[model samples]
Target: MERTLVMGILNITPDSFADGGKFFSFENAIERAKEMISEGVDIIDVGGESTRPGAARVTEQEEIERVVPVVTELVSIGANVSIDTMRSKTAEAAIGAGAKYVNDVSGGLADEKMAKLISRNPNVQYVCMHWRGHSNQMQLKAEYEDVVKDVKKELDERVAQLLKSKVSSDQIILELA
Candidate 1:
């Protein structure tokens, strides 16, 4: 078994639930990433949009502003950065800025271009999370006949789509949250 990996959450925006911008500055973000490295974080999940309950939607430009710089700096320092976003534009920009992974909580629902980003980057890893809609209204529609089974089913379909898009199956990881 690969064992449980500890992934550090880095919210670069100003509205994240717990530690939003508390570490958003480029210097502080880099320092915090280093701290996570010291504490043994396998992946540094970098999020520009806040998906917290009741969080507002962040635009693509704003998201890019929050994520890219941090990603480039983190990569320069040798940290494994995972860009947490749903928009394909944001994903492409982030990966270009040195992120090696895409952590989309929407699971390809919110943005249609997500699959394309994965398709174009064969070496990039993908983390797909279960999502119904934007956080502004996602919770009201949380109804699953078979929670676990449905989660697996949805994840399987996402994996299939990625495969069809030319994304290697080994590069995809399903997140059941």
Candidate 2:
């Protein structure tokens, strides 16, 4: 039997719908990550941006500052860390800080450079999520005759694009959300 991997979310944003502001501080975020690891989480996904509907966008620098430290600390503690971000710059910073995965909710659509970044860092795993748009406007673009078929088609297109950008197929992980 295949073991199910449990990924715990460590949102260090002030506006996330779940646990917003709870882990905004460095100490709180580190504590939460430690708690998740102690609870048997296979991976801790660290996010600095709030993807909640109508959530305000944060600057790239701010996002880096928010997550890189926590990611570095988690990795030092021997926890597998995944950076939950759509921006390539933020992903790059997190990867530099020792994150092993990039959980991009935008599926490499939001930022044109994301695929290239992933390609450059061949060892880092990439989580490509099916996304219609940003959280604030994604609902408006959710109209589909057959949701499953449409999502599959979109994901296939994304995969093709990532391949064209030189991202290895083996490094890609598909996510329906």
Candidate 3:
């Protein structure tokens, strides 16, 4: 039987939906990551910005400032790190800082450069989610004729676009959220 990898979420933001303010500090986040690793997590996904409904957008610089340090610390401890971000610049910085994956919730729709980033980084893992827009306005786009079929169709189109951009199939991860 194939084994499944359990990924742990480490949100380093002050306003995330579930664990806001708990791991907002770098030290706290690192501690949480260590705990997760001890608990058998295979991957640690670090999110600098909150995607909660109506949350304001975080600038690339701010995201980098929040994420890179955490990624760096995690990597130094031999953790497999994933950066949860929508901006290509932030993703680049996190990768440079030692993150191996990008968990992009926008599915390359929020930023055009996202696909190109994945294409350029052949070894970097990319997660493409089924998202219509940013959290602030995503609720307005929740309508779907057939939820499952529509999501599958949309993911297929996005995956095709990524393949066209020279991103390998193995590098892509799909989320039907």
Candidate 4:
């Protein structure tokens, strides 16, 4: 049986579910990533935007500022970094800074350009999470006749879109939220 790899969270926002903005500074963030690495984390998920239940969305540029430099630093130290974002701009910049993966919580709902970005880079890994709207309004939009099936269908369609755009199966990670 294949064992599950532990993913350590490196949240940089002030409203993340648990450890919000507590890890916001670059120096503190780098130290935490290093700690996670030493703790046997297989992937260090660096998030700039807070996706906690009632969190507000940050500007695209702010998200980039919060995550890119950390990704570059992690890359320099050989850390397997995955950026948590749905903004194509942020993902594009993060990938350029050496983020090995993209963790998009909205699964493409937040931005259509995200799928296009994924298609362009078949080598970078992707994690598409189940989501309906922005965190601030997501709670208001969670109603579904059959939540499981609806979420699955949404994910399938997104995956199909990526495949149609030429993103190979090997480069994507469909996150089941």
For all candidates in order, the CA lDDT equals 0.86, 0.94, 0.92, 0.87
Task: Tally clashes: model 2.
Answer: 0
Model 2 lDDT tens row, 1-177: 999899999999887789858989999999988988899999999999999887888999999999999999999989999999999999999999999999999999999999999999999999999998887898789899998999999999999999999999999999998
Sorting all predicted structures by TM-score, with the top scorer first, yields: 3, 2, 4, 1
Worst 10 residues of 2 by lDDT: 13-22
Q: What C-alpha lDDT, on a 0 to 100 scale, does residue 171 get in candidate 3?
A: 98
Q: For every model shown, what is its TM-score relative to the native structure?
A: 0.93, 0.97, 0.97, 0.94
Identify the superior model by lDDT, candidate 2 or candidate 3: 2
The better candidate by TM-score, 2 or 4, is: 2
Model 3's C-alpha root-mean-square deviation from the true structure amounts to 0.8
Q: Count the backbone clashes (under 3 Å) in each candidate.
A: 0, 0, 0, 2
Q: Where does model 3 exceed 4 Å of error?
A: none
Residue pairs with backbone overlap in model 2: none
Whole-model lDDT, model 4 = 0.87
* lDDT tens digits, residue span 1-177, model 1: 689977899888777787856976777877888999999998899998899887898889998998899999888888889999989999999899888899999888888778888888988998888777788887887899999898888888877877887778788888889
Candidate with top TM-score is 3
Q: Clash pairs of candidate 4?
A: 13-21, 14-21
Residues 3-107 of candidate 4 have per-residue lDDT tens digits of 997778899887777675778999989999999999899889999998888777789999999999999999999998899998999999998998888999988
- Model 3's alpha-carbon lDDT is 0.92
